[model samples]
Target: MKIRIMIVDDQALMRDGLSSILQLKEELEVVATASNGQDAFEKAREFTPDIILMDIRMPGSSGVEGTRLIHRANLPVKVLMLTTFKDTELILEALEEGASGYLLKDMATDTIVQAIKTVYSGGVVLPEDLTAQLFLDKRKTPHSDLEPVGQPVDRSLLTDREWGVLSELGKGLNNREIAEALYITEGTVKNHVSNIISKLEVRDRTQAAIYAVRHGISTTYDF
Candidate 1:
């Protein structure tokens, strides 16, 4: 099945360029385009595309706010932020708001297409430089003692082996990589990941990683 896509950018040229490029890909279809965050939200509710290419800066509402709204709506759409800004804070904000990935505005068309597919497949995508910047920002920020607001985390819920598996996961290791690194079977790594997700009350690996970071449970490992 072709992956349905939506473009949300204020610039007409950008929207047109992205649409033209995506139209050439047999595996993707550009279902709709919107000029602003509000329009994108409405169209997202109506069209419900598999992925959305969102621009970070817009007149009415910023892409970060829009991403938050889409996430709250609980739609199946994954949002890939496309923007010219390289601000680390902005990128982290978007990710926290539930963006699946981020891409630079000047990136090649093929890269953007690949990012859409990667995010749709439940993988997080970010430029290596941006990813480094994100980690650097995290490290530079002083650790806070405040706890995150949610169900209290149960440390006893995860076994020591499971915690080790999640430590690898928080470092952005895939199941195969985790297995190879830990000298374990891929099936075993998968089982550990599943248990970790269930214990953490997160929907995906990305969320699980975020949870680990927020709680300081997996901060020693680098991504």
Candidate 2:
């Protein structure tokens, strides 16, 4: 089945151009297009596409605000932000608002398409450069005391093995690499990953990794 997609951008050229390119893919179908965030949400509600390709900067409304609105509405669509800006604050806001991935507009068209596919298949995509920027100066960004809306998380909620796996995630290790590093089977790693996500109240591995990084927890803190 072709993945339904909605392209949202302030510029008509960007929206039409990207839609033209994306619709060429056999795996994708351009179901809708909108000029601004507000229109994007309206189109989303009307069309219910599987994914929305959002741009950060727009004249009437911003992509971050759109992401917040979409998440609050609990639409069954993933958001893949495509923008030229590398503003860390905007990137963080989008992530917090449940964006499946963030990509710079200058990326190769092939890469953007692949990111859309990845996000469609329940995977998180983060540009390595942007990821490093998120991790590099963590000390400088004022820490958010806000936790995911739930009962407070504690170290006791996880087993030592789960903590070890989460710390490896903080280092950006994939399942295979984490398994090899910890001398555990990949299936075991997958199981641990599932448990960690549930225990941490995170949507996915990306959020779990962010939680570990923010808490400064590591394998050394585990068994």
Candidate 3:
């Protein structure tokens, strides 16, 4: 089955260009296009695409707000942010709003295609050169002493297999990569991921990864 997608960009040329390139891929289908965040949100409900490539800045209902609304609505769609800025605060805001990944506007065409596929297949995507900076900036920022809103996490609740899966998630490894590392099938990895999400009580792998990293599991999971 082809992956269904929506392209949301304020620039007509950008939207058309991306749509044109994506249409050439046999495994992908551009089901919809929106000029702004509000339009994107509405079209998302109408088309119900598997993925949305969203611009960070828009005239009305910016991408961050749209992403939050989509997440709050509990849609099954995954959002991948498209932006020209590497601004740490902006990226973190999108992530906090439940964006699955962020990609630069100038990224190579092949990389952009693969990023959509990667996020669609349940992996977190960030520009390779910018990931370290993002993490470091986030860590340096002071967080409030108040606990985050969620069930108190107890790593003890995870099984040995789930621990392995959680560790890989923290490292941003997709199902296929996790399968190869653990000598399991991709189907098994998917099952493990679902089980881990349930156990962790998180919205998605991005949240799961943040939880794992906070508990120090990510330190050893790195490549």
lDDT of 1 by residue, 83-179 (tens): 7654656666887788876888898888888778777765566554455445555556678233442224565878878877876665546677779
Model 2: lDDT of residue 134: 59
Q: Which ranges in model 2 have alpha carbons more than 4 Å from their true place? A: 137-191, 201-205, 212-223
lDDT of 1: 0.76
Give the number of the best model, judged by TM-score: 3
How high a TM-score does candidate 2 get?
Answer: 0.75
**Cα distance off (Å), candidate 2, residue 60:** 2.1
lDDT of 2 by residue, 114-188 (tens): 888777765566664455445554335578444322223476879988989887876657788789989999999
Backbone atom clashes (below 3 Å) for every candidate = 0, 0, 0
Cα-based TM-score, every candidate: 0.73, 0.75, 0.79
lDDT (10s digit) by residue, model 3, range 1-223? 9999999998999999999999999999999999987888899999999999999988878888889888889888999999865566767688888998788889888998898888988788755336554665556669823233222456577888888888788677898989998999999988888888898788778877666554546555432
Model 3 whole-model lDDT (C-alpha atoms): 0.81
Report every candidate's CA lDDT.
Answer: 0.76, 0.78, 0.81
- Sorted on TM-score, highest at the top, how do the candidates line up? 3, 2, 1
The list of candidate 1 runs beyond 4 A from truth reads 138-190, 198-204, 209-223
Which portions of model 3 show Cα errors greater than 4 Å?
A: 139-163, 185-201, 211-219
C-alpha RMSD by candidate, in order: 5.3, 5.3, 4.3
Error of 2 at 83 (Å): 2.4
Candidate 2 Cα deviation (angstroms), residue 66: 0.9
